[model samples]
Target: MKKTKSYKFKEVDLVSLRELALKVKNQTGFRLRYGGLLTILRTNVEEKLVHTLVQFYDPSFRCFTFQDFQLVPTLEAYSYLLDSPIAEKTPFTGPGTSLTPLYLLERSNLKTTCQDTLEDILALLIYGLILFPNLDNFVDMNAIEIFHSKNPVPTLLADTYHAIHDRTLKGRGYIFCCVPLLYRWFISHLPSSFHDNSENWSYSQRIMALTPNEVVWLTPAAQCNGHFC
Candidate 1:
C-alpha cells in the first residue's frame, strides 16, 4: 500500500468578518442567499476528527472509503448547508482581473458610499477569505471571479475535492478549503445515538468505531425544504 501523506487543515478566523457580514446581510439579499455560510463559520471544527476522516480518503476514488462504506460530499449537501441556490449557470472559469480590493471598492455604484461600499467590500472579503481562500489574509482574483458569478456551491465542492486530492499527494501541507462546512457535512451523517452517548469518547475513537449500519445514510432534515431539520 502506498503511504498517504500527512496533511494539516487550516481555516481562517472569521469573527471580525462575521460581524461585518451581520451588518450587511440584511442590506443586500445576502442573508437569504448565503446565510448558511455565516452559520457554518460558528461551527467548531474538531481538527482531530477531520484528520482521522482524511485518513480514509481514497485520493484515486475521491471519496472516503471506510472498512464497510464509502462517502463523499455532494452538491445537494453543500447547497443545503449553504442555504444557497445551485446556480444552473456555469461555475467560475477565470483568468481574473488584476484590480486591487480598494479599486474594486471604488467601482461600486451605490449612492450611499459608506453603507453600499461596505457591503460590496464585505462580499468580496467573504469570497476571498471565507468561501474560496487560497491564501491567508488575501483575496485573490479567483475569489473575485466566483463572486461575480453569484454561484458558489459548485466551486465550493470542487475546491474541497481538489484540496483533499492535492494535499493527499503532497505528503505535508494545509487543506485550504472551507473546513467548518465540510466538518458539519461530515458529522451530520453520524447516528444521533453516537452523538448522545459518545461524549466520553474522543471524536476519532467514536468515528473509527462506527459500523456501516450505525451511520445515518440519509439525513432527511438536510434535504427537507432546504432547511436543516
Candidate 2:
C-alpha cells in the first residue's frame, strides 16, 4: 500500500483584529492630554534599540497613522493559536523552566508548522504598534489616564535617541506588566469563549477582540530589541 500524504491546516483571524482596531480608534481624544495615548505606546528605557529596528522596514512607519503599523498579519496568526489546548505547562520564572509565552510558542513549533508562522504574524503586529509615535504615555497610562501625563514631545525625542541602533534593548517594566493587564482587560470585555472556549469564535473575533490594551502598549516596544524593558 502507498503511504498517505499528510494534510496541514492553516487558519487566519480577521474579525478579531477589526474589533480591536475599532476600540483603538474609539480612543477618545480626551486621552489627548499632555503626554497622551501615544506616550504610553512609546515608553521604554531602551528606546534606542526600538527605533533602530523600526527604521529598517520598507515603507518606514510613521508615528501617527493606525494602518501604518500593519496589524493584519498578527491578527491572522494569533487567531490560529487562540483556542488550542495547552498540552503541557512550563513554569517560566527561571533558567530551567521555560514558562514565558515566547518559550511556549517554541513548543508549539514541534506540534504544527502553522504554529511558527502564527507566532511570526503576532510579532509583526507588535512591531508596528511599537513604531507608532508618542507612545510613552501609552505605556503605563490608563486608557483614560493617557491624557494626564506630560512631556510627550520630549519623551518621544528621548526615545528616538535610545532606539537608533542597538539590538539588545528589551522592553520597559510597564510593557511586561501591560501584557497581562491587556490580557485581563481582553478577558473582561470579550465573550465567554475568550476565557473558557475561544475555539468557537470566528477567526477575526478571536484575533481582534482579545487584543489586550496593555499588549497594545508593550508589544511595539518589546519588539525593539529582545527584552521587555
Candidate 3:
C-alpha cells in the first residue's frame, strides 16, 4: 500500500484568535462548548510524524495496526483530550449550508459589539480550521451541523476513522481530520524511554521498535489531569 500525504489546513493568525478567545472565555457556556481547544490549537503538529502514523492505519479494522497491537481513537480519549464533556448522542443530524474561515473572520470583526456572536464565530473557526478540516479555508455544512449539535466528540472520532479509511482505500490522498489531535494522542502513548531519545530516530523507526508492553495505554492527559498543557 502507498503512504498517503498528510494534509494540513492553511495557517491563520491563531495568536489573534487565542487573544479573542480569551476575551470571551468567561462568557456563559463558552468554556464548556470549546473546552481546551485553544490549548490544542497551540500544539506543534509534526506533519511528517502524522503522515508516518497514517501509514499504519488499517481501513478494514478501522484502527492503526502496529506490530502487535491495534489502536483507534475513542470518544472517551477525545473527551479527555479536549477536557470537554461528552454525551451519548448523535451529532450533525440535520442539513446546513457551507461556510468558510473567511466568512467567520469577517463576522468576528464586524460583530465586535456582540459577545455571543464573537464567541460563536470563534467556535466555528476552531471547528472548521482545526477539528474537521476538509478544504482549505472552507468550513462545510458538516462542521456547522456538528457545532450546532453541541456534541463534537462522536463526530470527531467518526471523522478521524472515516478520513483514514477513505485515504487507505484510495491508496494515497490527504487525511482531513484533526491531525494535531491525532498526533498528540499517538505520542502520548509512547514509552518514556522513546521520548528521551526520540530526536535521534525517525518516527517510523521508533514506532516500529516498540512492543505491546512498551506502549502506555493510559496516558496522563487521557486521565483529564491537564497534562495536555
Shift in Å, residue 134, candidate 1 = 1.3
Question: Model 3, stretches more than 4 Å misplaced?
Answer: 1-19, 22-30, 220-229
> How large is the C-alpha RMSD of every model relative to the true structure?
4.2, 21.4, 4.0
Tell me the spans in candidate 1 whose CA falls farther than 4 Å from its real position: 1-5, 22-29, 33-35, 97-116, 196-200, 221-229
Worst 10 residues of 3 by lDDT: 1-10
Task: For candidate 1, write residues 126-229 as lDDT tens digits.
Answer: 67776777755567888888877778889999989999888887766888888777888898888887766436887656766789899877765455646433
Task: Encode model 3's per-residue lDDT on 1-229: one tens digit a residue.
Answer: 4444554334555676676677674644776657877667778877777888888988778789888887777777787777677876756665556776777777787834588788878888888778877666688788887877778888888888888788777776667788778887888788889767646988887888899899888676456644422
Model 1 score (lDDT)? 0.73
Worst 10-residue lDDT window for candidate 2 reads 75-84
For model 2 the local lDDT of residue 175 reads: 23
Estimate, for each residue in 40-149, the C-alpha lDDT of model 2 and write its tens digit.
33333233222222332222332311212322112211212121122233311211211233332344344453533443322332222332222322212221121122
lDDT of each: 0.73, 0.28, 0.75
Worst 10 residues of 1 by lDDT: 101-110
